[model samples]
Target chain A: EPEVTQTPSHQVTQMGQEVILRCVPISNHLYFYWYRQILGQKVEFLVSFYNNEISEKSEIFDDQFSVERPDGSNFTLKIRSTKLEDSAMYFCASSELLAGSGELFFGEGSRLTVL
Target chain B: GQQVMQIPQYQHVQEGEDFTTYCNSSTTLSNIQWYKQRPGGHPVFLIQLVKSGEVKKQKRLTFQFGEAKKNSSLHITATQTTDVGTYFCAGRVSSSNTGKLIFGQGTTLQVKP
Candidate 1:
């Protein structure tokens, strides 16, 4: 079965440095999303993207965070300056446009560790 | 935004015993989805429940959506060691523009052989 895939399974960056997490959602999926889970915490929604534009975002998705669908297959989340609290497992998910059945498939996730 | 709550943060069951997890949402949901994440792994889609009071079964697993569309349950019969993982219930909020998922805290299941 086709699945969502993310690059850089694990990343380590300096506290003030920038980091970009990349994801390639299923080819036919139309809606994409980014979620994060802090250690021992619930999964939090960060942002959702559709039609190459942002649909919704949470408070955690502040100015420092940005998402782009630069190409048909690539969805990226960039953090301008990483903070220690921003270190977590970032997951990328996608769903088909089918109404009433918006099942999302998630990637293995990129573990971001900022020191 | 709607929030999903799962009961029993953790569950320990014998290999051949039955296991069930319950999920409740603060508001009505368009649909409820179930996911599983193994230790040190990513979340994998298990099933999605739509329609009020709908019940679906897949092999040894059974899923139910509450009549009010605000709750769901996943039951696994004859649990095996492979069933040890964290189960999450995600609710789909119907917005005019887009649909987003609100995930529950999840219930970690430990199956002892």
Candidate 2:
């Protein structure tokens, strides 16, 4: 089956450094999302993207965070100046229908470690 | 803010035993979804419930949505060692169209052979 793919399975960065995680959603999917999970914690929604713009975002998605569909197939999340608390597994997901209206296919996730 | 809560943070069962996980939402939900994540793996979609008091089954697994649409449950009959994983329930509030899902902490199940 077609699946969403994420780059950089693991990343380690110093606090205050910038980091970018990339994802290639399923070719036919129109809605893209970014979610994060702290160790042993619930999955947290960060942002949702559609039509080349952000459809919605959560409080956790603050000024430090941004998402972009830089190309036809690439969706990227950039964190400016990472903090220790930013360490988590970041997941990229996509769906053919509207966000919650349909099932989401998630990538294996990019584990970010901030020191 | 809408929230989903799951009971029994962890469960340990012997092979062939039954297992069930319950999920409750702080607000009525438009829909609820279930996912399973194996150790060190990503969450995989298991199923979605969209109607009140709906029930669905897949092989040895069964799922139910409460009449009020605010709660749900997943039950597995005659569990096997392959059932080891964390089950999560995610809910979407009826009032929002943002498509954001509030996920529960999840119930981690360990099936022993």
The candidate that achieves the highest DockQ relative to the unseen native structure: 2
- Candidate 2 per-residue C-alpha lDDT over B1-113 given as tens digits, one digit per residue, 9 for 90 to 100: 77899998999999999999999998999999999999999999999999999999999999999999999999999999999999999998998776888899999999999
Question: What does candidate 1's lDDT look like per residue over A27-103, in tens digits?
Answer: 99999999999976678889989889999898899999999999789999999999999999999999896323767
* lDDT agreement with native, every candidate: 0.90, 0.94
Q: Candidate 1's residue-wise lDDT over B25-84, tens digit each?
A: 989888888999998888888988989999999999999999999999999999999999
Clashing pairs in 1: none
Q: Please give the distance, in angstroms, between residue B103's alpha carbon in candidate 1 and its true position after superposition.
A: 0.4
Docking class of 1: medium
TM-score of each: 0.95, 0.98
Residue ranges of candidate 2 with Cα displaced over 4 Å: none
Q: What docking grade applies to model 2?
A: high
